[model samples]
Target chain A: MVRVTELTNLAVDLVDVHKTYRKTVQALRGVNVQVRRGEIFGLLGPNGAGKSTLVKIMMTVVRPDKLVGTILGRPLGNRKKLALIGYLPENHRFPPYLTGEELLDYYGALAKVPKAMRRRRAAELLEWVAMSKWAKTCVGEYSKGMMQRLGLVQALLNDPQLLVLDEPTDGLDPAGRRAVRELLLRLRSEGKTIFLNSHLLSELEMVCDRVSILVNGLVARQGTLRELTEHTVEYRITTTGDLAAVKEAVERCGARIDNTVIILNGHNVAKVNELIDLLRGKGVLIESVVPHRFSLEEVFMETLGTAR
Target chain B: MQFCALIVDSLRHALDRKLFWILVAITVLVTLMMLSIGFEGGKVSLFFGLVEAEVDSYDPLAASGKARLVGVVIYGLMDFFLGWVGITLVIIATAGLFPAMMESGVIDVVLSKPISRPVLFLYKYLASMVFVLIQAVLFVGFTFLVMGLRWGVWVPGYLLCIPLLVLLFSYVYCVSVLVAVLTRSTLAVILISLGAWVVFSGVRQAPAIFDTFPELQKHHVTHQVVRAVSWIPPKTADVTYLAAKWSNAGTSLDIIPASAMEDVSAAERGQLERSNQWEKEQLEISAFSSIGSSLLFEVFVVLLAMWKFTRMDF
Candidate 1:
């Protein structure tokens, strides 16, 4: 397990990737995403926002009309470098004919793992995924959640430096989702970079170190969870005073008064202090001040609502 | 190493389908039928009413027919059965291969691997060839044994069937891969490839038919048109015909079709000889020129298919 700190600084640094399919239908438009080492980065977008296409470009599975990127410090599409990256496609369909163990072996061999290592790793992965009992069962017999677990095993087979999972928990049950979330965090802890593409907001909120919201072939918002949600916040101030004086002082201080509460519009601490002083000067005591920050889901909605 | 894995994985892919086992079973059944052929008397006895009465009167097996000629007879029988029927069944079993492998959700997993797209494409094409190989081995191996033990004539030329059948299937499979890449529909690949095969076979034989009838010739130069048409596609039918020629070690002229040799007058026999001479010249391409020409055409189509496949987004 190689930690990102132990390696180079960036796992993925892509710039201005534009993909136009068949001379029409532009799928990606000048998208730039920089993923730090050992971080779980979430890519959230509505359907057809090109999140999968972006990952495909990084994995060298999709040929972009114009591409500028380095994956794991190597130029995109470098065959040797791709061995250091693992990808699980959205709605992935592994060959139904292969047994669970055979599926791992097949992908492990593709990843150029040695025979002994592949055998040992396949067993270890199956056991880790709690799928050892079903190792010999044909994949067609596995449930959707089971397939997702097996897919994750395949993605990890190479002990990749960067793991890209498209809709990783799309078909998983609650427990399965929780397990995958924990597994992703563990991978991050091991210093492996993760690029997760999914539409599930809460899942991303819970696990991702940083996130990017994409809409209409463009990046709508991108930053750490705190960075995205902390700017321009609405502060809730509770006060015990006459409503009219509170409203006048609140209006004078440039904040909206929602009944007894003063809702400050800006994230500026100076304005909050000024408003609190005004309330104190008016002989009204401030009961409490609780800063309200938006959740990632709200940021995602606000980001995509621009497309309307 | 990854290339080998893709090939082995694809073989498993073929084996997973019931179509593969069914084709193997049919090959075994046909081999038994070929083995049931008895020659207790000077007259031939074919079991299960395959040709109970007609095979007896066939001049190819007349008392005057030489023992080496028996190899030619067997060559014709095996070539017509294995070459034509066997190759057709193989195409039916395999035409959907590239399309099925390239199915949307499926192909992404393979394309994402470290292997180069062109290498993967070509290897999977070879993997689809595996389905035919198993049948070819069983069919030719059993037929070789029965031909040697029952007929007492061991023609090593029988070994050419395996490679030749592979070439024939490959010739048509290029079309399958191209269409599968373009459309990703197994039914389309099967219909279009088999349809192209029908057109190629139809064109290859049309010249012979046009040359046979003076009435058809009087309408126009049909054989000339057929020759022009035949020059385009890989000469698949001729590849099979060349396999029959190779089966006889290139020494024997094609035996006249049994129906054409029935009660022939001397004057008509002379005409038959002239016709057979023209036919012999048509089929007399050197083994190198024969297989090589078709293979070059297959290569051209496969290259085009690979180009599209590598550039493809999925």
Candidate 2:
């Protein structure tokens, strides 16, 4: 039994969603997720980990074996709810005969945008994606990266409250990747919820405020990066003095000295502070103290290994 | 709105496809060839001399069987080649319309919008029907035009055949769409459609196959069997039959009633009245079996396609 919530607060919520293709290949196994308003939520997973499958279930592109979900507080497959959401699939292909502008207009029209509004939005989206010059070019003539950008533009055409993207930046270059990141951030700033699935963990780390990682059709870990990685602590300490004294003080404070450096592991902030205080008392000048940010890749690998 | 958008997009895509143009060209060329063989001023003879002209077995009674010969030739050509072309062109064009779009991932983009599955299916089917109607009308109309030019007069009844042709061909297109949904491979769809076409058209011609089922051995049973196999092609045969009936009516032989043929130039008004009554009765019967079957088949196929399309995943 799923509880009904206020529409204005939650962008997307799925409880015990299950999807099996052809009565086999259980792509989603009781996956639960909730994306709050105005946050870029990343659905991170490897190939065949049900990333796209989950997105498809949410968008109603494919029916779920069992879907207990809601979008914007409305039940899934509700047309009124769908009008407020835009989706870009992993492999976004449009009718090759249609030009970029025409394709956008077609989707915009399908989304129930007025004719005048569709045309205006198509132009604005094309310009925003930096494909205004190629607006008239047929989609088949566009490169893979250009098609990806166009797909992103189409996804944004309706000014949807929630944007669902699967592998949105799969074929993008560095510059294109940066542009997409900025676009998502801007949308987030404008109070839009972005639900994204990507293989690029670094980009997810940069853009996503929260993320969920799935393994073998189940969510292995999910939370803000700060919450998930906070349990592991790493510190950088610089001090000028006799290295032997600093090392001795670090060892005395229950810290390990590695390569002439004092290292503190785990959530024992008291031990790190003790070492710092001892070094200061020894008249060893301290330069800087910084905590290393944990990369999502490392966290993901660790999570996957633990799940296995 | 979603349905309308889908229809517009489908129409645009269909118009832009190279296959559409190729089909149009082939239809025009075939119509021209049929026209050049001039429907009027053509002789229909049943016998040919084998070696030297040493008294061939042609009796004067069988010499001028022009109407039946023309009917057989026209129906045969329409059924075998032109009808096949129409069905094949439709299958090829619409075979990949939805299935290929799904396989190529384009359907995801479409479905991601606010469109409903049923609406998408309806609109695409409508678009395909419209295309079929346009192509079929053009083919039949231009053929009629060339026919009028060569024969020095246009047969008004030929225009009546347009709806029949459109209905039959649209049904085939609908079936192709359903087959496409069932198997999302264009090659497989073509093969299956062609096989179905062959089974419906050629299988009934074999006595053994018809004899296996006692129910199909009745008078109109073969028609029903053929209709069950592939409903559209036989409808084309029916349309051709109606057109032939109309063309035959314009001839002098058709003016004389079977009863009045013995007493030539006697009781002209009575013969004309009786002939008109008999023609009306024959027409009513033809319309029931031929035209009615075509209409029913089209409606059935359309509904079936819509149902399947709505239930399909993509």
Candidate 3:
């Protein structure tokens, strides 16, 4: 197990964390990863890939058999440090008797926030989540989307240093998802580190500055979005006029020709330039040059499939 | 402050469940029934579907070993409600506390907070006790007031039932908590608690029943086994008897006649004598030995639960 002392910029730096459930299933196996400060870090994994378990260990909701590292500059499982963290567990269920405002207050109180501030934060978050009108409505009466919004509000009650969200937009409409993306961006700009575990590849791709893909209890890849997608870069060149000339020019330069279109593969920047120069030299009117990179979903599927 | 919030959270959870209100309503209704029984001069008037016709009533002021039959009957019913019916309601109401809290999503959010697991577990335990405590206070407090206003005697000892009822319920609640932690099933908790209570009560009657049939040597062995079983589950009956004894109410229930033991063997007779003395002393001594022994068992069970809880992954 790797143990690092407090590093200020590291919001969550966990190393060699392992957990074996009931002495039978090893949910997490020597997983090591770090989430940088002031960045939205998305953790992508398939189901039963130990995403929630890893987060639970960081939150101290679950104890790992072998865990070493720090969260928010404190040792893993530090109780007081939790007050600085805002967590939204997956599929959370709130007390039915409590209204939206009351539920916020309850979570706020658990963080040991004082009376006036709890109410103030509750009001602020309710409005921020567009739940101000339903503040007094019972949680049980609220729809799933409403509850997800309220869950987001409850997570922000403490104004935490690190916001750990598991499937934060699990039950949201398209507009709600867009709103959450905006909200997360706003929170990010406020200098809060977000550790997000989400199955929505597109959502994560849009919001996450960096991402770690976990495959079968291991960190398969972890880096900035640029780093993960850089290798999958490809280029598509379109030309007009003579297709025979375009194909002849593109084929000579080792590019695939499909009708009037020439497909350039890989991060071979020089090859791309060679093809562009060759097309122009052939006097074929160039139409379009499109650089294509793998989407987060494609990367995820490829990573998972390769791991299997 | 967080601890208080956790307790409030638990209270809020209980408030959400229908059982809590049902138990509260029962306590209130029972308290009202206690208030309806009246004794004036030498006549007793009972309301609540009981005897409405005037009957002879005993005076507490008299210098005799006699209690107003109406007062005794009311007190008996009071004990019965708070002891048996109230306990059942409490067990059912709070049985789901642990299981509900320990549910996957629920436990994660709560336990991930800045609180220790043991302290959190203990707060939950105290929270369950609060349900019984509030109901007991209301039930005992209202009945005490009625006993004073109607019977014209203020037995502060009656107020002892509040704590006694809490202690009695704690005994069962402790078992319910242990079972809940182990099974995480509200129905399982309730069923096991009810089963344990029934077994304890059945075991308690062993000595009395053995004294009734001392002629059978097998009765002696059966009585011994039952008495041993009594030491396992918390002596809830012993707590009830202790409350009655403290309030200067019905003493030990002596069923078999002394002459009935004469035909038995000397050893069997000796066992009968010792058992009788133990029961009498059990009530008079505040049922301390039985309750103490039983409380130890509850503590052990709770410790087992806490140990398992702290060791659990989630």
Candidate 4:
């Protein structure tokens, strides 16, 4: 539950967002997402799961059928407030006739950045993205990765408070992806909220402070990394003595018995101790105990399965 | 500043198209052709005096002769060439602008900017006219210079063609934008706008066509409907008369001189007389009424396009 008094602290607070395409395909259904200021929030889902649609609604690129929320303490689609926001849409195409520098200047002008500031930022961002040499090259001549780098520069031109990027690493090499990850961290450190929509679970696991998993036009799960993956932790105890002697007893203790291990499915320490004592009574020597938590990929798969 | 940026972007985009340069080349060629024709005293010389013909009434030293020369630039160059052919090519060249802007990736980034959709749409629509504006200035400027330096006749009123050309393009472009917004298809925009230009031209000329033919004028209901419907679409046909009137190029009789009419038979002279009368009546059409009504129609169409643009999902 969120208090009304905390709305100012949220960079994005969306409630009951719904969208239908062509009156047949329902893209989003009652999506509610919140991103706190200065935090990195990730939105992950499979293809056609309304992740892009939700992002588009926030950016005002797509009109929602019914949306009730505020962004950056103001209502959605507020033009003045949008100056404080920057967006890089997936598969974005810049005007090919313009050079990279000119493209940035054009978009910066549209973003309402002053002329002097636009030029300064364009130089800094191009260099920061390792694209200084390609600044004068027309976008039509650029590679996909180069275009993606320029897109990042354009997105950062206004120095927005809330940066929204969809598939920011869609067409990059390992070095480029790492650079983007580092850039996101740098932006976060500057107290700018970041909303990242991506399908790369590991990437989100590496950076996102909290994430919501969208499944079939609805949020299936929403929480921090620990909150989502910790519940499925399993404790595996390896023993020296054969586990056939205590198989039935181990099953009765709510543990599964392997040939040389007892697999405990929960975080109950007392239950594990009781199982160990029973094993010791049966003369089984415990070698090692290892606890394992599910990865984000596993958690995502499980959420998808459960949602289905 | 946002609108200026959009205009610059649009100009750069237009510059990249081959058709733009091709039009520029054509303008240069036409200007060169005009430069090659020289007038000395009462004689007209082609190819810079390589071929000369005597004409008593067309001497460049006289006021009437100078007016006729200015009439050549105003009626022949501005009206016939720039008004019809140039506008058609511009419509073809710029028809893709709105549809291209609405392409998925392109529109996504633009709409995300701080500007509202209507403002963006209106700005882009205005920016797209930079192509016509540049062409008109170059064509008229070059011809104005040729008349001043070569023929020794300077008509400053001829400069009005620049804004008048842009206004005419906007009248048709409003419809093009409406169609582009409704259907994001360049081909549809081109076909429909060209077809609409024809329809507008036909409707504009229907009254004159009826007046010229006594039989058509006899149908009272049809004549009244044609006259009423003509007020709705852009007055494209009126632009020629307006250009002639503003430039002070005089009537067809004054421009043609009495010598040219001497060879005509009585029947042909009567026909020419009625044609000249119609031209006089067209010249009498009020500039405010024509331009104001056309602008009203453009505003309505543009508002309709903006309404659809703001409501669209892209």
Q: What's the DockQ of model 2?
A: 0.62
CAPRI-wise, candidate 2 is medium
Per-candidate TM equals 0.91, 0.81, 0.89, 0.95
What's model 1's lDDT at B67?
52
Arrange candidates by lDDT, highest first: which order?
4, 3, 1, 2
Check candidate 3 and list the clashing pairs: none
What is the TM-score of candidate 4?
Answer: 0.95
What is the C-alpha DockQ of each candidate? 0.72, 0.62, 0.75, 0.84
What does candidate 3's lDDT look like per residue over A1-308, in tens digits?
22345546889889899988888898899999899899999999999999998998888888888977888888876777888898999999887788888788877887878889989989888887788999999898999999999988878888888999999999999999999899899989999999999999999999999999998899988999999988877788888876685676677777898877788778898998888787777787889989999998888888899888
TM-score of candidate 2 on Cα atoms, chains taken together? 0.81
Better of 2 and 3 by TM-score: 3
Error of 2 at A272 (Å): 1.9
Q: What is the CAPRI rating of model 3's predicted complex?
A: medium
Task: Give the clashing residue pairs of candidate 2, or none.
Answer: none
Where does candidate 3 stray beyond 4 Å?
Answer: A1-4, A241-254, A280-283, B48-71, B207-212, B215-229, B251-279
Scored by DockQ, the top model is 4
| Candidate 4 residue runs with Cα over 4 Å from true position | A1-7, B56-63, B252-271
- Score residue B166 of candidate 1 by CA lDDT: 77
Among all candidates shown, the one with the greatest lDDT: 4
Top TM-score hit: 4
